[model samples]
Target: MTDARPLAFELPPLRAISVAIPLFILAVLLQPSVSARTSRRLRLALLVPTAVLGWISPFRWRIEPVEFAITANFRWGIFSPYFLMLAVWFGAMGESERKNELAWLGFDGKAEKKALGVEEGSTGHSTATKEDGNAGLRPRANGTLLAPKPRPVSPLASPALSLVSNSSLNDQLPTPSPSPPVDPVQPPSVVDAPPSSVNVPTLTSRKNATRSYSQRHHPLRILLDAAHLLSAMRMIGYAGGPRARDLPPAPKNDKTFFRDRLLAFYNAHLVSSACLALQVLDRDGILASYLSYILPHDAAVFVSATLARLCIGVSLWVQMKIGFNGFAILFYLLHRGTNAFLDTLQAILPRRWSEELTWRSRFDVREYPALFDNPFSKMGEGGVTKFWSARWHFLFRATFTSLGYKPTLALSKRLGVPKRVAQLLGAFVVFTLSAWMHWQALVSARYNLHPSPAGLAFAAAHSIPLTSIYPPPSTSLSFLDRNGTFVFFLLQPVAVFLESLWVALTRKRVSGWAGKVWTALWVVVLGQAVVGKSWLALGLVHGLPPLHLWSWHRFVLPTCSLAPMPVFMR
Candidate 1:
């Protein structure tokens, strides 16, 4: 008989976990104290572990499958905080700059200016003077000189004039000073000019004012700017309450405002996602193709998945607000888990793969033919081709080209059409495609699969319209209406229309009531979502059990057993 012996296994090194724990703890501790600025820094810091663990030697070391898998998963899990930190950080940084700029533009009030270290009436000017030997000069209260000078220098040199008489002649010829000391008359109160009137030098304006204005007016630019503005407002504790005069101009048309805000929110998220793509492409070379090609192949799938995540997150928050604790936590965990997985995969992949993936995912030959390889490309091929070859197209093309990827092919060849016209057409096409895809996905998913169509439709009908009328309420409504299926249907088309209108307006294609009608639709949709039955359904769904509890228990929630109804015999 052989003696039985237990097998001994060597444990894998816990370097990744060791590194992650301290940082995780630090981030948790710092969360409450994380101002917009610090939050960004913390996010950057979190990336250190992601980068380090991703590059750790001997990642192939074998342990128990469960333990190894958990560790590998944990490495990915860290990316949630990593990407989230970066998103919040980037948002905060951009917002801080935007608020400062807006305040400089005369949109923010005294308190905001003070909080940003912006002097009232300062006009972004530096107090430091150039050393042209005019250091002591100070402008007088009434725009008059204190004393007449013997010789007048150049008008430019007048800035050097001092309040006190500095000439030796005044010191020598002071014999009459003892006669009498007249009381100095009180100087008339001089009101300073408003800062908005002061011209501040800007690189964007100086380089090319027309281009700058056009770029700033671009729908994407407007959306990013709005995101920054909203972030700044939230940071300054002015997220809610009465309208502040210093805030950036609120959307004049309710529908336009709602649509713009939604777009801006989505764009901000995309930008962060783009960053992840860039990181992944830099790491994994070929595997990133799944993200770049397969996912983006069907625009509807991409939009639906992205929007669904957002809606679910918002819905979870809403459930939490309305006292549905269990559902909220479950939703939050699922969302976080999925987000973490995606973020980690991106981080772990090679940079080349990631870039290729991003390019393939965002643009396709079918949708964006201009980006395709064409042998006989020239001027006036078609409306779409003409639009792609315009001057604005070249400018936008150049912008993306400079970023190291050519979004459109044949950008090197100059088309006869004006740049702005082409750009407007391109922008319209892009927005329309994105919006339509999103709308189709939401409608199909909600109507086909949802157990409670009436509840969802009712919620959407009210919330959509209400959000347009009152934009702030949209955010809350989204949170309360878990899954945001209703909200998505209402908002997506509005966003598409707004983008199209913005492009048309840019190209002088349409204006006035036409614009207003398009804008109004967005407002109505948003309003319906905010005040709709969806809000009510959130409470109802949480209170009730799954429609087919036995089936749900067998598959969806295996931990729970269904209660059976008793039968009555007549």
Candidate 2:
């Protein structure tokens, strides 16, 4: 058995500087061209440069402990291929989302401010719209917009006096003369404000004109906007006229898109959060190690992968019974800590870099959604479109569309195939690609026992290391079989396709008691691999060492290295 280590990366300051010079030049020269051109063909051209850099990036290096062994980072240089792929994806999208894409990459844009109807800089005059009256006709102070103050009521205009048409006192009061015309360019002076002789009740249009909360200039708005941009990035395809049930309803207005108080929050946001959590799970090293402990074991033993899995299936019920791990307190802390650290990184980036990372926008806390539906919590009436697009949030939508959907759709049109066929074919390609990616990920596995049943886990570590430090496996497919991770993902498209047929036949969804039963059964059976993988990754196993959950060395004792998989950080 050969020992493999994660790729080693070191860019000495001088070498990094050398690399940065060329990258900077390329970025400046290509930014405009890439931004304007949304052609898939043009974006595909990026692959050449990316491949070249992946072959020769000076900053990155790797060494395996065993001779002939290869590292994961060796797959794609510095993850540049992934980074470039995402770049090409951003460039291929519509112009509207391009702003979002750029914002994520740390580009400054007036888009959010413009979208919310706020203009930059002082015009040295009022900037309010006619519809909003003079209430909005005020200059910003130190860049902060404030509500217009109310006019003071006069003592002479006593409580006893009634100006209403219904009051008998109305006849005794004289009507004021026509007021002087207000200058549009001239600033309104507070000292010269109209007297109570005018007897006009104060009306505030600021509340109605501006959103109750400001998204413009919000610090973390960029992150929120980045999240939206990333989610929407997956949906940027010509996949037929959108069906109502297929995707989450488009934001009703700018308010909902920006989450103004008046607009109701959409369900897709919750789905996005759920998808992100799943993504974090897979990227973290914990799941992979846990899977290794479980999957390569026999079904006969108690708390074997199967038994542990079954226990997992009933864990919520068990937790409910014990009333321990209540309210998911542990999970809540972990989520907050990780997100806080991520936000800190986002905030620390310089303006140019920040602009590249996100747009100027606020993540409206008011629009904060409660966890209800996730990618898997579907109840029918919704087809595969609804399943993947809305509920699933198509975590890899952008990648999938760029890699599979667009290419197939283009070819299908040339061959004159039906749109539905093209769509299903595209979906199949996506699933296949996903399965393949997962399969490749399985190539590198290191065994570790959970805290409890450690002896059994060690005993079950029977499979030969598919890829080790000495040399990599011949193919990622070598790790696959008829019934494994690949098959699990491959089966999704078929399930979705069949479910679509059922919806067509019945004109109803598979939800409620029936859907719940179906979901649980599917999870227990078809989804066992995924659940087991996740439980391990989450460090949820009974006897998994607490240190193993946080440290790379403990998880794979005797040695560890910086991994692209979040294991290094954990």
Top TM-score model? 2
Model 2 per-residue lDDT tens digits across residues 67-88: 1212222222223333444554
The number of clashing residue pairs in model 1 is 47
Task: Give a tens-digit lDDT track for model 1, residues 64-179.
Answer: 12121221222233233333332333333332222222321222223222322334455443232343222222222321111223254564432222211222111110000000
Error of 1 at 337 (Å): 32
Which portions of model 2 show Cα errors greater than 4 Å? Answer: 1-46, 51-81, 87-303, 307-372, 376-387, 444-483, 520-524, 529-570
What TM-score would candidate 2 get against the native?
0.42
* Per-residue lDDT value at 304 in model 1: 35
lDDT of each: 0.28, 0.35
Report the number of clashing residue pairs per model. Answer: 47, 28
